[model samples]
Target: MIVFMGTPEFSVPILKMLIEEKYNVGLVVTQPDRLVGRKKILTPSLVKQVALENNIEVFQPENLRRNYQYIIDLKPSLIITASYGQILPKELLEKIPAVNIHGSLLPKYRGGAPIQYALFNGDDKTGITLMEMVYKMDAGDMIEKSEIEIDSNDDYGSLSEKLSIVGSNLLKKRLPDILSNNYTKTPQNEEEVTFAFTLKYSDEALDFNQTSKWNHQRIKGLSPNIGAHLIIDNVVVKVFKSQLSDIIDIKPHEIKIENKRLFIGCSDKAIEILELQQAGKKRLSTKDYLNGQNLFINGGMTNE
Candidate 1:
């Protein structure tokens, strides 16, 4: 029996694939629900919903030992975790070699926020890594890996969706081998170890003082969700899409509209805004935005 552990929409495909292949999924384990957004609405995770649809037993564990011991008691043949937030304890590892579906090519970005971080860092390529779960943070021997290139304009949301689909198919292919016998894993060099860590609201605020190239990375990393923002006359403006410029005469925190486009020229880099959303307005192009409001704040393009 396979014990599936995950908690997001990305994890749904793998779980479904296992069921389609006639694998015995003993139970699905996911985290407990918590309030989200201003409404404080509690929502069950997407993985939980999928498992319930399949009539599979579900475990929402607040504490690994207390709530999840029942699953350990069942003694499933294998445990597969894809985007399961919590760390598996040593006791649980003793029961079985947990197979994890990680987003990045192993020995690379080894953490919860791999997809977003990769886009943010402007990585040329990222892939899915299948690894045997041991104790220390994503430090297991990799079972297999597949790489996918990041497009110049690709953001976190789009990249994540594609990678999730790739992960699902790769797991389907590797499952038979993983379940049958032990496979070799290459140890990730500590020197090459990097992190996604957890992204925060503050991280999403774009700083114009930095080079437009770096600003590009920050915006892309936070794209599609938790987007980068700018403060224009006490109103928060989201930068949904942008590109770098060679203009070096413009000052920071300034917005200039020219040729029906919004270009915020900076010290060494200028940002060409393609799409944006004001605090309470719908996202629209620079031309549409200009037409919508008569009074707009036009900060100085001059460094002075």
Candidate 2:
């Protein structure tokens, strides 16, 4: 029997793909449900919800390190993981061969936030990697890769959805070779290795000291989820969309409004805020926000 491990919406397509292909996915392992949102309502991880819907058993260990014997007891012939939040213990992998469907091409963005880093660096392309799961993080030998182009307007939400689809389909195509132990393992180049560590709360703040394009990429990298925010008059405003602006000659952090357009000064150019949310309000377009609020005024400055 095959064991599947994953969490988050990114892993849902992959789990569904396996089910559709009639893989004998005996058990699904994922992180435990936790309280979410201001209401503090308990929420199951997306993968758990999908597993239940498909009538599959799920294992959510509070700490997989201490509670992993359940997985070993099952004696699954193979394990497939995608965006599984926890690292499998070396002992677990020693007994069961496993593979991971990673979000980025191996030897690049080999960490938790590969998709976010790809956008942060303003890359035009990103891809998924199928690799052996070693004890070390994402430093696995690659089995196959599938590339996808990033649209100029793509943000974290859109790009993640795209990459998730690609990742699942790639796994489907490669599963036969994987099960038969007939796949080649290409070791990633040590010299080309780079990391995309998980983002912290502090990483969400926008820095106007950078170029407009740079800040724009930052906003896109964090959008539609943990949004990239700016502090204006000590109030947090989450920015979800922005564009390079032609308005110039303003100092960094300066706020400019003209014809109901909201522009903020960056080091080299101005960035026009397209969509944003105030501390206690729903997200709105720049024009709608300007029509209702006076937080940003001509010549006023945002907190740097």
Candidate 3:
């Protein structure tokens, strides 16, 4: 029997795929419901929803280190984890052969936020790695890996969705060999290792002093979720989509409107804002934003 542990939308695809393939999934472990938004409404994780719909036994543990005995009771032949938020204790790792479906190539971006880091660094390619779970974070030996190209237009949201599907398919393809204990294991090289740590709230603030290309990467890397923010007229604006412009004459953080389009000056060039959301307001295009209210072209944006 397989015991699956995962949380978030990224993990849902793998869990669903296993169920569809008629794998013997004994139990699913996911993070507890979260209080979301200003309303404080409780929301179930995607993995939990999928588990309930499929009639699988589900466990939501506040602390996996303390509550893992429940998983042991299930007698899982193999434990599979995909984007599971918490780290399993060393005791649990020693008991069973746990495998993790990670979002990036091993030894690179091996942490909680691989997708965001891959886009932020402007990588040409990133892929999924199936590895044996160790006690120390994602520093596990790779069992199998599948490559996927990171397209020029791919943002965090789109790339994450694509990677999730890739990871699920890779796991499905390698499961039989893994269960039969026939797969080869490769130790990740220590020298090439790079970490993708969790993003802080300050990471959302865009610095126009950087080159336009760098600023543009920051905008799309955190798009539609933790948006890249900038101060315009003392009001914070979250930038969702932007492109580098040829204009470079203006000072950094200078806002200009041309033909009802919004552009902001950076160090090397200007950035044409395609989509943005002002504080407490809905997201709007440059044209729609201009139609509703006037902007101060003379005022420079504050970085802080």
lDDT of each: 0.81, 0.90, 0.89
Residue-level lDDT tens digits of model 1 in 173-254: 8888888874566777788888777666777777777778777888787776567888766677787778886666677656
Model 1 scores what on Cα lDDT?
0.81
- CA shift at 249, candidate 2, in angstroms? 1.7
For model 2, residues 36-111, the per-residue Cα lDDT tens digits are: 8657899999999999999999999988888888889999889999999888998898989999999998799999
Clashing pairs in 2: none
TM-score for each prediction?
0.87, 0.95, 0.94
Candidate 3 TM-score, C-alpha based:
0.94
Best by TM-score: 2
Instruction: Rank the candidate models, highest lDDT first.
Output: 2, 3, 1
Which rank order by TM-score, best down to worst? 2, 3, 1
Q: Candidate 3: list runs displaced more than 4 Å.
A: 294-300
As for candidate 3, its clashing pairs are none
Query: Residue by residue across 1-304, what tens digits does model 3's lDDT show?
Result: 9999999888989999999999999899999999976478999999999999999989999999998987877778999999889989998888889999999998999889998888888999999999999999899999989999999999988988898999999999999999999989999999999999878878878998988889888987898777899886788888899988989887787887889888888888788999888877778887887777754454556767
